[model samples]
Target: MNNAKKYNIKIAIAVALLLSAASFTFLEKQEINSKDNLMEVLYALGQDYPEHYIEKPDSANIKRGYELIHVGKTKSADGIASKAISKFYTCTSCHNVEREDLDLTLVDQDARLEYAMENKLPYLQGSTFWGIVNRESWYNDDYILKYGSLVDDAKNSLKGSIQLCATVCSQGRELEDWEMTSILSYLSTLQMKVEDLELNIAEFEQMNSLAESNPDSAIAFIKSHYLSKSPATFAELPESKEKGYSFEGRPQYGKAIYELGCQHCHHAYGESDLVLDNSVLTFRWLKKHMPDNSKKSIYEIIRKGSYSELGHKEYMPNYTLEKMSHRQVEDLRAYIESNVK
Candidate 1:
């Protein structure tokens, strides 16, 4: 198949892990507590972004996320909070959300039949992609594993491509990149819904079975069922009140600016091993290389960008930076000074 299609198959398999690593790398040392301000998180991300999204992540992340999805980009928002809603804990964990393990009724098992059919293949070797993503114990795909594909004989042409990608490339399919943006948007707009959400399911079921029980208890459980994945309520979170970093008061206004703008992809705050200077200065590899500028002259390589797909793997979007005001740029410069010196 073509390179784009090949990329699709590969991305489908391990997109989650890649996205997780990419988003978490900056915060590798920080905890993602529920209490942290969304703007703080957004600001930090703006600063440490992969250079592809340096200018404005809220705008860029959603925009880029949608672009990928429109073209069948699959890996973008797998790690976005809306899709995850706190991992491993089910509604039964607290009744604030929903049942313990997700209702089996909601799962589609078609991928399983497809997998079983694959085991019958003699030429279908193994997968490096699977080695990375598959925990080995869990089924490859819950939905696909349970139900078989509904492909007709005429559409069988797509089968070889799918099988080849799954076996050899090891890409996964589920949350597409574009869906990630929508998910992020949902997360960005999140406000808690149900208040007394937790259900005493046992109490609930018992009440339902009783001839005369507290109507309120039954009402509570029924109410909780609908809010299984309700994120922390808007009331619980201080974020519902619009909060932004005030530029005038903070001593580290530069840091705030950097967090809000430059830190995403460039090595402004600290030198990273991935980027290069005019002299191609890297720590050890180009050991003796020299440059004339003792003072680092920073410039916006990508106006709205952090990196380039044209060739630079900077991951920083270029056009986005063009939107910045001059004061913001100077603020970023001052922020970098603390790290630069």
Candidate 2:
């Protein structure tokens, strides 16, 4: 052959090999993606898959649900306004609609505090409503202690739990059929996505490789990354020494918790009779009561929240150790005491 012909043949052969390799790689990726729809994987693993989960929820239902959650009322399809679900508290009073923790796996309050401050979300007593749809159970752990017989029905059934919260916990009436459907549709929109998983590159590759042959391993691995249920362990008020009274609390963090956690229901136009603001009077009252073991003290009120009485249907929900740490409670104290006039 001529020298030019030999060179052209070599180039053609190399190009063919490259194209063949690229095609194989593309096919491999396509196969992986087909199997790696985490939602399907979770469903196959018997992960409490909903009967009907739509990728896109109905916009009007979502709007009504959102309004109901935030304001305790919404308009029906006919443009008629529904009655308030609760006169005292809306869903947002104790729960944030957005994600609170930076890492989904860790329920660490400090990390959650940082994320809440960064994202401008309330550091609430209840778990965030962001991924509530994906969670297998609700009103978990020591919540049974407070709810008593009510928790029995709600422990496993999402709809049952929603009704429990609406009627018992929130002191509202039982939700109507349409209202229940709308709220659930809204929650379904908040289901966890694949990006929320903590898979490393190597782990992702392993899952991709093992997807067909050893799929159970990948399923279990994904499940391990996040909790199916939020834990709630109620704690007692700390003793004087264990309260970390000596340690200087971070006022900046404390301020965020106060505004986001406390003032959400305790400010002017908020749900609480004991209104809280930047006013000197509020600060002074909190400071004066801090040394005592009264409900007015942050230490007492936070750990041992008030319960509903005959006349008082509205009551404070106690913070779980998982929800608010001892340090964060102290941080709240520092912030309140700092503002004392």
Candidate 3:
């Protein structure tokens, strides 16, 4: 080949390489800039995405909220205590503060039991407060039947629901405005982190790609990954004497439900007078009285929870099908039988 042709070919290849390097640099810069947008988009669409969340929660307010939830009262820096929120129950009596299920979309009792065991938390009736701020609805499903007209006002409003729980559910008075603000501020701090979504690589890429051009689609996509609201369905007590599952129940799993779910409210430091420890007597009592039509039976009590009378304001909340499955109840029976034997 001619020397002039060879020189032209070398120059062409050099320009191509330089252009490729410049393109790579530009793409890297674009990705870096989009990182912030990625977080914004994820949080907007992620689980527990409340309509409005405080970006910065006040530490003082958070402490007050914490105290109110665990203790049902707030204390001043000077150590004076505010009026108790409830005579019967604190928020922690029924609700957990952390995530309960492996997947936010799942409402399985077995999975929740496992989660509780893992996290050292008690299995309770109410949903967790971890993402309460993000939930669009509250006091859902059968709650309407219990609360009646009150549910109407609380269903769509978080503040309303809080008030309903405080007055009716907790058997407490209405919260002061500042108290409400502080509780909300504390809940805001519990917003789900981006990592909680567990987005895969391709999903992360899609999120990044749509972070700017079409955020609505991205938001919908992420929302689809987790439940926007926890569901509740009441289960009727079994008609016949037999309530066991066809398959054998796992006594180990049932043991957890007994300890975390039953013992949580029955033992010392719990809400109930009935003391259920790791005793053979408790097991024998459960085995003999297991799940009949009687309200004292495990099955009947779980399905049709007892109502509070004038003398007792604190009452057991019935477990929804979503909270405790038929299989789980059978498992509890199996556990009791095992202990009795």
Candidate 4:
């Protein structure tokens, strides 16, 4: 029982107590139980998604930044600063967790099908979600290998990954350039939810722009990022053989990737607000729910939630798969790299 769970329990109990004498008493209690279960489920999920959820730190600053991102970084500067001070981390640093016992990711094809069929929820098409948020989240998760977690990586670079992730998760951080630089400076050291950074346009643009300014640095980033996975590296593609790897390029992949992996609740044609945040292509609803999308395609996002405008909806789905097809994912990646709109 972590403190978040404990507190949630107290909140649930308080609600139950308040509604004890109501006319729909039984229903209220049932609802309370369900809510409590949801919280517990979330706690279990946090443990499962050790990548997305942060155990509130002893440091006040750390907790504050967590809260700021929770409320959407673009929406809360004071909160982010307060939290950053204590935790001395970034949005991507503390999100990935090792315990897979309670995650709720829904990237498995079969599980996703079942989820869509059973729940009255509808997002399984191809219209929602910003490509940017998911793109960052995916990269960060994969980046885990080189940087040993986004938090540590953030400590050294301060600017590249951290700022981009913060912008997406917060739906759009409201930081001035200098503030962003400072925030980003602290963000790299974070080690929890880098996997959950939102795939928003803001974050991706920032990251891409940063990369553009320093091609050598960008290449180094990509190299380190890919190396983390220890994938078979080519003797080296002629640097000119391909255009490049980037956040913009990732969305092309993200669009198709989500179509196959997360179209269940994040459909293209729907009654819901299931659309990309002009950022990464994965659905916002799905991004926050499952940070570890092994079903993730090339340029997969490694971030989390966004602002009300970008995400603009509620309800997170769970997609879980122990394994994914590399060839299939590669196909999607190739297309995104070559022909993303």
Best lDDT goes to which candidate?
Answer: 2
What lDDT score goes with residue 287 in model 1?
Answer: 24
Across residues 99-134, which tens digit of lDDT does each residue of candidate 2 receive?
Answer: 777677767888888888888887789888877877
Predicted structure 3, TM vs. truth = 0.83
Count of backbone clashes for each model? 59, 0, 1, 95
How do these models rank on lDDT, best leading?
2, 3, 4, 1
What TM-score does candidate 4 get on C-alpha atoms?
Answer: 0.26
Q: Kindly indicate the candidate among 1 and 3 with the higher lDDT.
A: 3
Per-residue lDDT value at 251 in model 1: 22
Superposed Cα RMSD, model 3:
16.3
Local error of candidate 3 at 290, Å?
Answer: 2.2
Weakest 10 consecutive residues, lDDT, candidate 3? 19-28
lDDT per model, in order? 0.28, 0.74, 0.72, 0.31
Please report the candidate that would top TM-score against the real structure: 2
Tell me the deviation in Å of residue 171 in model 2.
0.8
| Residue 11 lDDT (model 3) | 58
Candidate 4, which ten residues in sequence have the lowest lDDT sum?
229-238
**Model 2 lowest lDDT segment of ten:** 19-28
Q: Under the 3 Å rule for N, CA and C atoms, how many clashes does model 2 have?
A: 0
> In candidate 4, what are the lDDT values of residues 1-341, reduced to their tens digit?
38995586455434433322223221233111211212122232221322322222222333333334322232233443322321222332223211111122323433433333344323221111111111222332333433245444343333444443454332334345544433322222232222232324554454344444654453343223211211111121112213323213234434444453444324344222444332434433333333233323122331111213343522221211122233323333444434323
Ranking of predictions according to TM-score: 2, 3, 4, 1
